[model samples]
Target: MTLSLNDLPLRDDLRGLTPYGAPQAPLPIALNVNENTHPIPDAVASDILDDIALAIRDVNRYPDREFTTLRESFAEYLGHGLTPEQIWAGNGSNEVLQHILQAFGGPGRTAFGFAPTYSMYPLIAQGTGARWIPGTRQPDYTITPEEAAEQVRTADPDVIILCTPNNPTGTPLGLDVVEAVYEAARGIVIVDEAYQEFAPHDAPSALTLLEGRPRLAVSRTMSKAFAFAGARVGYLAADPTFIDALRLVRLPYHLSTLTQAAAVAALRNSDVMLGMVEEIVEQRDRITATLEALGYTPHESWSNFVLFGGIADPRATWQQLFDRGVLVRDVGIPGHLRVSAGTEAETTAFLDALASIGSAS
Candidate 1:
């Protein structure tokens, strides 16, 4: 017999929940999800292929649960004097976050973040049965250290999520705010810097603050910059003790042999792998500048995506782009929409489409 979710004895809180994702319909120009628009450089692809072949030779054996080599390579990439013992790896940054909340947040525990930030932060808390509390950001999509501290003091969350160059908005928070949040809360503080590679050169990473702050964890991914999203590698830099705690929560051999090999190859050829970042940054700047010139309010973006306000109807705008063979994100923020920075040609197409829409409006 057919049944509704309520008939399946699902958790009451999860009964009405829709899964989290942006629309991904494989449009001609897919700027909806914040993904790398560039294909892997030929040389790098060749190196990765050879490494994958080597890794698959031993596929019959269980992969390394420790992910030791990947962790060491990541530690070197992070370069805040991090040691392999202090690093942890998971399928994606999302899984790394789940491990964190599982370790520190639970039924009675709470996790907090600033609003107009990463939507997944709250959803991750819900998945772990932890209460999610969102504090407000400024009108410009930034939160002050004072405001963040007060929110932490009030909520007393067991985990704090700081999304640097935060998703959707792309606002980079200063380390001051991170420090304040860490000091005001009693639990683990996670600074999600998934897009840090796209930020301005001067943008500081929370990894720099890891020396004395054992409770502070900085999570990053090879997806955006390294163009390794398919590799499924995300990691964190924290104290070795905290890394040990994640050992209890993560599944055994979570990082596959092929995944490990791919990540290692990417890290080994870091220069070639990250070569598109500067070019992508150029496209992002072009998008921001063109949006500003068109009389829309493009919030300052340090990530590879731009979120622009002044959209009278974001759903209509999204549909308009979709109709034109492009797909951008309608991030539920009224009067605004987000578009990822793709190839220069993709950027021009987006601009030309928006210019048309504006003209007709």
Candidate 2:
């Protein structure tokens, strides 16, 4: 007997979606993606090779389904006493966010976050069949906890995501705001600190708020500060119960053996990573100053990149930079572009390029 093809309930929300793509090619200064342009130091590279050599025997077998050891090491790296049970590791924190949305959000549920934040939040929510809602942010791009809490009350969303030192803008939401959101949220409050290492004054981590708020999940990525973008390791820390739920939805052995080995090595020598972060912060300050000097006002950035308002049309400015062989991210926000802070040499090159472009314009 021939079976009919129309027998199932198919999700139509993701019908025409185009997957996310990272930048490709021979652009001179790649400050588009917020990647650390530095390579792993030679000593750290040697350690990673050694760790992989030792862990080779476990490759034939599946990775620990729970990733216990890696989770423990990651928690320690974060200076939090979180047990493995309270952690979830994924291929990247972006995947961790996806798993969260899939587990808690779907048809009839809502996932809310501020507009002009991470470009991926709404895309992920829609792909999971959740209603994606955009909330308002203050003029400085910071959102108050009270505003967030009120949105939660009205939207009754299944998930609320906040990006501190937020993407593209680099403005940080205050800790009191986070506490208020935690108190207000009946569902999950995800604080995505993808740029936490560069945040000013060691901004309060959501892990600190986890004791009282069971639904708070803080997602982090090694891709940024660790110079391990290719390693694809990201993690989520939360109350054990919420973490347990994450495990149920996560694919078994989702983090490959190579990824775990790289992550463990990276965490073991994280002090080296911190040094690079410090350098990037210094570069960011210099870039901000240069932009301000050029008569372009830049937002106070605590991340590895700076966001500024351009004197000309932002698209025109981006084209000018492109023509000058310095690639930056034109975030489509009016008169705004975000430039990733690179090395001292690269920063000098970018400034020179910007100056040439500004003079000609």
* Best of the candidates, TM-score: 1
lDDT of 2 by residue, 1-361 (tens): 6754344455567655677764565887888899999889999999999998878878999877777779889878876677777888888888999899989997889998887799899988998789899888888787666787787688777899998878989988887888887777788889998899898765677677778678888889998999988888889888888987887788878987878888998899999877888889999999998888888889988789999985568878887888887889877788788899999888998999888876321
lDDT of each: 0.90, 0.84
Q: Can you tell me which runs of candidate 1 are displaced by over 4 Å?
A: 359-361
Candidate 2: give the clashing pairs.
none
Candidate 1: lDDT of 286?
95
State TM-scores per candidate: 0.98, 0.93
Backbone-clash count (model 2): 0
Clashing pairs in 1: none
Evaluated with lDDT, which candidate comes out highest? 1
TM-score of 2: 0.93
Q: Per-residue error at 274 for model 1, in Å?
A: 1.3
Clashes of 1: 0
